[model samples]
Target chain A: MSPGSVGTVATQHLDLPGSLPLDCGRSLRRVRVAYETYGTLSPARDNVILVCHALSGDAHAAGLSPDPPPEGTRDGFAAAASPKGIGWWDGMIGPGKAFDTDRFFVVSTNLLGGCRGTTGPSSTDPDTGRPYGSAFPVITVADMVRCERAFLAELRIDRLAAVAGGSLGGMQALEWATSYPDQVNNIVVIASTHALQPQGVAWNAIARESIMRDPAWQGGDYYGTGRAPDAGMGVARMVGHITYLSAPSLAEKFGRRLQSGGDLRYTLHEPEFEVESYLRHQASSFVRRFDANTYLHLSRALTYFQLDLPAAAETIMARTLLIAFSSDWLYPPSASEEIFDALRKSGKEAEFHLIDAPYGHDCFLLEEARQTPIVRDFLTEGRA
Target chain B: MSPGSVGTVATQHLDLPGSLPLDCGRSLRRVRVAYETYGTLSPARDNVILVCHALSGDAHAAGLSPDPPPEGTRDGFAAAASPKGIGWWDGMIGPGKAFDTDRFFVVSTNLLGGCRGTTGPSSTDPDTGRPYGSAFPVITVADMVRCERAFLAELRIDRLAAVAGGSLGGMQALEWATSYPDQVNNIVVIASTHALQPQGVAWNAIARESIMRDPAWQGGDYYGTGRAPDAGMGVARMVGHITYLSAPSLAEKFGRRLQSGGDLRYTLHEPEFEVESYLRHQASSFVRRFDANTYLHLSRALTYFQLDLPAAAETIMARTLLIAFSSDWLYPPSASEEIFDALRKSGKEAEFHLIDAPYGHDCFLLEEARQTPIVRDFLTEGRA
Candidate 1:
């Protein structure tokens, strides 16, 4: 029930005719892209903006979903309060929100290595007649952009008014701009970087280790097995849940308040602190909806993302809108500043808007109101 | 060798004559403590400076340990470069170093609920003649201080010239000052806090969850099971290790360097990034040395530490020295500032020094040279 939420929508999938080449030097024979669209394509198809999803996100970026996927799509804290059945970015893509579906068509897609109806590790390999699981080729952000481009080509959309997303999705948008500079008119990257900082790399590494170490993971071939690496994935989610939030935000949400009413329960196995309990809840919920191998693939790909934005400076015709959150230690404002500085140095038209927000990297998804004017004005003014 | 090294020390054990009371409303019988001493006791016994160790450290503080613990004592990433046979803080506690063993008899002990030859979850329970394991009562920082007080009492020492430590050890130091306010004359709390911040709480919680979720942990009673929760504990260590260092330090140390030259190995099962490889090595080494049950107990104990320093203002006679590193996001200078503000507001003697270092929480162990002068000046100035 957001002010301008796009009405109920369903994800649709399309298969690429040719094999999609991956950075791993392996090509996927049957590549499928699951997508959802808000707004309408103009007669010339010049108003279409390609939207990408983050590490755990999917095609349903805005509007209400007709059906909840087997695993819930709601991740992050405050998820319980987020309008149920609504898209992840429901607040930012509608008649009058940030993306402004009224004037421009916004299309979101599940990334190349996603599990949500996207041909990923969980998908059956046509050659082996088994889930790809361990057989899925390692993909890169560039490869994801390639898949998105091919998916759009099937729709007969050769050029885009813009490409946009946050976190991993933002990486995809950057890939689109850098790889197909002449095709994308503008790029909106939020709470992302040209490269993940080292600590961020370490966090992702630990998360992947957690999943792989689980005996249930069974060498990434656990799909046929009834059991999943839920415990390990839960721990991974907990780590990610904390990273997506700033310390101050956690402090405000759950301080050292004990789960028990007053005194310490004096139990080692049970959750004591309110934060501990919250983390457990977050972890459990995350493990249920996400695929472990898909997580490993996506995490590895994002970790490997190192954009040479400067090298593509000459060919890039896109007017870039780079938005970063001040409290996003995972993707700090310094990275956005680096991007902006590089773009300006190359004499490219760009606007960098750093939102002074406290929610950490989650700010990109949560701070919809603040981002509206900036994104709207940027896109509209670029046209003007 | 460290300058003025208190060379070739051995950990010694002593059993308390009576049962020690615990915060869990239970008492531990036949409680034993392992300790190492540097310098010599004065005729008046007033020259004793009790130095506590951090979460993973033991009684070995300023010298070359004559006998290496079975699993080895080195835990940091720079363990290879760190001098062999030396204590974790060998550089910081010698005759002319921070503790200045030349003037003061420095006493170091394996903390209560520690795995290092102390009466902890890994130790034998007098009643069952078996390892306490999950049966061990949860202990707190105050309980650790109480045990320290009892251990010192057994040695016929009624008061301490100073009590000092970093991280978890610093928590115990603050606990000592507040619990036995009249017994401790001065306290040096470095890169530690009165209470763990919410984010820190989350990290520790995730770590504990990592261990508990491992099937081999067997509800924390896996001591004799032949199968240890090495995988889970390794993941826990990886998480803890990353948190202990700054992002920039990792960037400087590892960057985006690949383990195999410059190409992606295109494998998910193996470590590709140098940081990932380093983490695996660190985790395996840590899992081999550390006890998972003891980790659970100690992690739980530290999480429960929420010292209300201002509440004990009237009884506190100790002059406090608070040292915080600039890059220590884990502990942070803001926490030290809070402690300083509380003491200052209570009209207590306190000095707050913020060192501009980049090692993060590990600064307490790595930036020994920078800390020595501040600690020595603080201790000596108090004596003067």
Candidate 2:
């Protein structure tokens, strides 16, 4: 693989052959998976690595767009995929980076319930010929994994060199290992949990409530309306952003520092603290890009995550590496400990590491210096 | 002193004679303070103990209503002062409890910017004959203490036996000792800080934002409309409630427990977890009783709290007792440490205790067994 081959990337769609059986005992048909890929498939097709995204992530995982992104990228992409096409994991996936495109084929797909190019709430319904919106079926972590597995089938990849992600992406990594233990040889999970803690669940619930309570939400049927539930979505994003950064990080960055041009006194209106101004900016920008119904679906899926599959424990074969951040209150050290303990109990080889970082849940995304070497070593040294 | 004397509690109002100057350099005239007293004042007024209420607290500190509370109790009171007039500190302010009404005359007053029968945003402006609303002057911890000082002067009490409170009330107690060093003999502050931390300020800012964003807020002048910004206030209360309780406590009480009627799987429209239901109830009840404008004012005051008073180091003559809960992230142990270190550096006799409790910031309010003895011992054994 060369840098030139990875530089020009576009989202590609595949119509999955069969209906996906959901965790809710329902089935989804006419499933279209949108994905992006880099590197090349080895002759044996064993160099494939699947990259799953967390909540609000998309298929645009890497590459710089010399040209504009694929046509459907903007219509539903929840994350900030640059028009220049820089991916979320752009730092970790070049010729010599962690994934090391020279030796590994990388596949990144938007989650099933995402608003991106993949079929989700913002996608048109085959039966009604309209966006799914409120009519979209609720999706679980298992359902998302099933769609990705189908995508793997479409690519004719029999086994994976590794499956990796952070946060909700990490959740999918765990699910991939458990759902099909024989297919994955290595799994890297970062700053994530098997199931949502009560506090995490509460935050998700409140975020959803903030959206639902918006008059413009219109019971998740705001797609046809000119106005989306941007206020509710903005509040949700603000709340989520707070959890993404550590308290110490906020204190160090903003402190009680008043916003520039604002008086250091109390007021009934106006942003006072720098943190408030920052949060406002984060919320406003998020509402303009993300789909509210997709947010609702994905957030709900997070609450339903359960890694206690008895059958998976018995058959699990993946060599696992679990990483937790010191300040990630959303997915704390204890959450990773639970997964580590469960894997060891099941007679699997699992390694756990806690990184000391102030970025909180976002440490996995930002601390590339610390992460790249560890990930490269794990991916390279473990395989036959 | 007798239990019978304490049982016949009465709420008293005093119209302050002079214009009350604010920390913001504004003067508030026609100031009226509503307070409730238990037990009789000593002959020398030396046994008078002043109790300062927290953000949502009122003059009704402890008492059972024979029939029901006064008419205005519900209209303005910030906290859950039952119609039967049960005090906020019911467990620790009785005949033989911490404050021991039998031994000390106890006085609790609503803060200046509070809605609870105090001249606040809900109170009428003498000039316009309408609610002050946004016109109500931004207040500080010092202003609240000043109003309490006036109450003390009206009662002809030269010195206090003690001044005590928790949370925002704790801020007031610190203010009482520092602002008028000669008037307060002892100060007991619990689950509070010398100043608000950046995270605390952020939370308060978000809560206030939640309320201010409500369309019904109407620039803080909804008095004639007969409609309050309940949705915004409810969201604010929900956010506040999350900070008040610890993650461990929430996990222990409602760990992934689903609401009884909800299904086990993901749903976009319903409250799934028990914690979500619980928070919703908390928010709904809070908005019904709390005044939105007052929430804004009080929350802002919390951000402005500062114990860096130049005179406090030299003039704070009160014997101090500072209690911090280990799980209180809002006002953590470090917060109390700041206050304790300040008091000790000032050459004051101060005792500090960090109680290990899972109740978070509300530990001071809920852990009566732990706090009652510490407070009683400090008040009874410290005076020379």
Candidate 3:
């Protein structure tokens, strides 16, 4: 394995004896969850910060161990490098950023429906010894949060200093605060909402449909087969990539400029404009590290997210800070306002800020001077 | 034989003989254009108002003859009923509306590469007698305008009282002034721009990809194959429909409401929210009337549109009105400013108005009260 790559972590399975009734007509039995952790736990075990990844993200959040595993032996759990890997969150995390690694013990785990060393559709069914694929039970954001809590208990972490994330990660952060209020002290929800809007669900449904419609999908059981649903997955990624950007950002990066040819071929098959090529690149990169079934699962989970439970808000233990962007269409500024209103109505300690950024929904991932002070002040307040 | 369908118009074919050199290195030839017309041509042939339609709209601008054609007739050019039929443009193009049908002899024609009465990818290729499908040559907005000019000449109309349209129709109106400066008198371009922005192209590309990736697409030759690419086309429409509405509209229409059931299903395959169902409805309606190949062709044409021909601006017909909406994201207010600036710089008669409407990009199609006065004043000015 490459340096800084986290090899396949050991899977510890647990069978929760009772059955939990789901919103769907089905019930889950003997629920088993798999997870991973990073950094050393403090004596008090109260400095934990749970990092939840987005739909395609995994448990590998930060640095790798010094002893590396053999190459190809850590395919699933190995933390894949981003185009600018650790640098993707350089301004927000590290030794000196808001999520300072030197002070807090960060624990980033693979989501329940994820394929990165987690019990997802790609996992082998213990009974049939084949990939679960279509047979795997569908999951929700609440279920994923439950799995994270289970992983923390297994690691002996009793409480969390804060739970924070953006996009789907932000959704998980909100869930953490509501489902297990006593376990979290502070909550930072960035570029997210209480639930998915129709536009958001509509986009997700199309992406899911694209993957399932691919012939190579083989009803989601394509594992062990030489061919994968690359085409469908690529199309789905293209859709997601579009949502991740603000309109202004796309125009700045790839205007009506033609590709290297300097001229457009009036043919439907060929990509005439530079924007088409740019989207194709984003799609191809995603297919390399993601599983089709996992994408479908996670997208659905996001669509079903809801924090309207009276009980969840009534038992809140953490003070919340909601951050939103002006140009984010996917999770617009209005979404942040709704969450802030909910917290206020519940008589909870909550603060909201709408950051002026033209980078759209993904502004949280970009570097802006305005965000630094806001985040710094929030994280450093009343710290022991 | 549907009573109100726009497919009943008799089509007149014109073989365009001009070989215009394009910026795209490729030269187009043997351009066969199919079109339709409405209203009687005055003896002077000067009282003409050109009507343009949106992306999926056809030339059957208005009116349906009470006399029906005999059954089993294979004639494809009879004027068909509009989707909205008589009520669609009730506020704009009735007897005494802004487009006063009694005074002006209105003309509307199906665009080139359109599946309606016009020659498009679905039309039998003269060279092969087979549907062009994926093999159809890509077209540009300028090419579409070129075909429109031919349709106008065949009707013996030398000049138009005003050229008006919304969205893609608005694009054609602007192109008319730039491509054939002297032929147009008054130009009313609403909720449109000189070129497709990066965000617009990105959305269009995703929509096209969704259709192409569908297995039923059959490389664009799904016609007569029983299985159409409805899933992919529906997904494409859903993406477009989102861009047409404002964030405020979406929140108000489908907040966090659950679909019929109050419970949240933990499954990935089911839609636990009401918003997903709403999008599905929108997507399904679009697929029923649109052809996948035509959608792909027209979307690409919209992306390639650019009417800022500096040299042509000096010679453009005077008297132009540019209208934009504050909430329109697809064609933001800034785009309208660009057009207004160009016309003013060229010392032409031009006026720009930014209407404050919360309907997003579809404001022009929805707000008739605001659009009526603006259009009426522009067209009535300096009229005979």
Candidate 4:
């Protein structure tokens, strides 16, 4: 293993002891969570920072995975996929990294509605002994947080030094603080929002529509049908990829450069621009690795992540550290400012930092070195 | 009928006398154009203003269509669809409007590769007596302008007082100014760019992918299959709808408002936000009237609109007027500034007006009143 890295790790699974209640009022039995841990758990189990994964993320948040999936978790131009087995957030979680595995035990779990080794729409229904498919109940960020809490209970880790994440993962961090206020000491919400802006909501809606519209989706029952909504899900991934990036970044990287030499090829069904080819690559890569039904559910969950934080603001125990990037239109810094304002209004400890960055929402993952000092300072304050 | 209104107009068709050559080194024969004309032709034959339409637009640019199609040729929330038969740009092309039909003979035509009563992909291929479909030649903005020039020749109209349009339409205007500089007096290009930026290219690519991925598209040969790529086209339209409007406009209009009740319903398939429903409505309504292949071709032409302006700068005669909106990200004001800079560099007469509006690229259509005086002044100078 590389210096300061958590080395190669294996994912572990746990079945919750009871039914996992969903926001849709349905209870999902046989709920299982896939997780990975870095560093040793202290005797008191207090030096814990539960790391949450965002949309299209898995439990492998840091270090090297002994066995990487055939499709590999990383999307092109998003992370440090130096080698295929490197974790999605390997830059930020290590012995001397932002999470500082030397001082804290870090736990990362796939969200409830995820397709990555978790009980999701792809999982079997206890009653029918078939994939839940369309029968899977809708979930919300709170339910995801609830599943994380239940998973932690099995590990005998009742409280956490921090609950942290970015994008949807950040939403989960915010949910963790509010849902289990007494259990978490600090919450780091990066490049996320209390509720998506209307335009953001519209993009997510378009993505879900793209997936569900595919005839091969078969109303979310394509499992074992020898067909999948890869086409539709490919479109969904393309849309998401564009939204996660800033205009300037695209300009700097691809600009108006053609994929081929000089002359224009007047074809309707082919990619012409470098950016067009990049998006197609991303779409094809994503459709192979991700499940369409899970995309629909998780995208819906993130859009439904409107927090009733004011209601739970009073008894919240966690101190909030909100970090947002200027170019993150998906989850603008204004949302973080709103959170900080509300927390201050409730006399809760909070800090909101707007990083003037150009990487857009992906900055939370790509701008790791710049974020490390700020995150380490915040974590140190918590220890004080 | 109504004050300052043209009252009513009918679209007329004309067949080109010969084969029209394309930029791709191919030729389209037996080409037809659908057009509408208002006001009188001057004795001197210099009072003609050739108006062009953007993607999804047609020859019916003003007045009322006596016989509207079943789909009504209207997308909800786009234009003044107050009375159904109203032309898409009726507000800006009437008796005392910006185009001032009382003074100038305003001519509007469905573009070359259009589905609206013009020769396009849906047009019959003489070789097989079947719709062009996959056999349709790929077209560019220059090709559309070439077709327009041919269509005008059939009318014995040699010179244009001005050529004007917005977005993709604006690209056509720029093409005419350079391609036939000696034949045109002035040009009005609104919310357009000499070359589409990489981000814009990415969005267009995504929309195209959405349509092509639909099974019903059948590789653009779904004409007689009793089905269309409506599902994919719907998703494409949804994407276009969002991109055409600004985020602040969407936030102000919808503002995280729920679709049904005050609380969340927790449904995966159904839309939760008002913006989501609005997009669906826009998508569904669009697919009903617009041809998917036409959309694909037009979108491609617009993306491939990168101009070698510097090469064509010398020996160009038209005075240029470019207008852009502050919030128009799809065709941002920066593009207008670029055009102005390029024109000035070439010692050409050019004027650029950046209107500080919040409607985004749709501003060129919606901000008719604000654009009137500016357009009027520019036209008045041409006649002076």
Highest-lDDT candidate: 4
Assess the local accuracy of residue B90 in candidate 1 as a C-alpha lDDT between 0 and 100.
Answer: 81
Question: DockQ numbers for every candidate?
Answer: 0.89, 0.60, 0.57, 0.92
Ranking by lDDT: 4, 1, 2, 3
Cα DockQ of the candidate 4 complex:
0.92
Model 4's CAPRI class is high
TM-score of chain B of 2: 0.92
- In candidate 2 the C-alpha lDDT for residue A159 amounts to 85
RMSD per model, one decimal: 1.5, 3.9, 5.4, 1.4
lDDT of 1 by residue, A1-384 (tens): 546878889999898898988887889988888999999999999999988888888898888788876455666664867666778888789998878898998999898889888889999899999998878888888989999999999999999999989999888888888888879999999999999988898999999999999999988889868989999999999998899999999999888888997988998778888888888888887887889998999999899998776776656679999999999999999988888888888999989998998999999988988999999999889961
Query: For model 2, how does the per-residue alpha-carbon lDDT over B50-142 read when each residue is reduced to its tens digit?
Result: 888777677877775454444323221123443355567766787888988788888888889878788899999987999998788888888
Clashing pairs in 4: none
Better of 2 and 3 by lDDT: 2
Segments of candidate 2 deviating more than 4 angstroms: A1-8, A66-85, A260-263, A309-312, B1-10, B66-85, B261-265, B309-311
Kindly provide the TM-score of model 1 when superposed on the true structure, using C-alpha atoms.
Answer: 0.98
lDDT tens digits by residue: candidate 2, A1-384? 244236867788888886889888877778898898889889999999998888867888777544453332221112334344567777677688888888899999998978778888888888899888888898898899989998899899878889999999998988888888888999999999888889899888888888888778888788878978887777787778887778888888777777865456556577777777877777776776579998889998887887764445566689998999999999999888877887788788888888998978888777766888888888878981
Candidate 1 wrong stretches, greater than 4 Å:
A1-3, B1-3, B70-72, B77-80
lDDT of 4 by residue, A155-218 (tens): 9999999999999999998888877888899999999998888899999999999999999999
How many backbone clashes can be found in candidate 3? 13
DockQ-best of 1 and 4: 4
Better of 1 and 4 by lDDT: 4
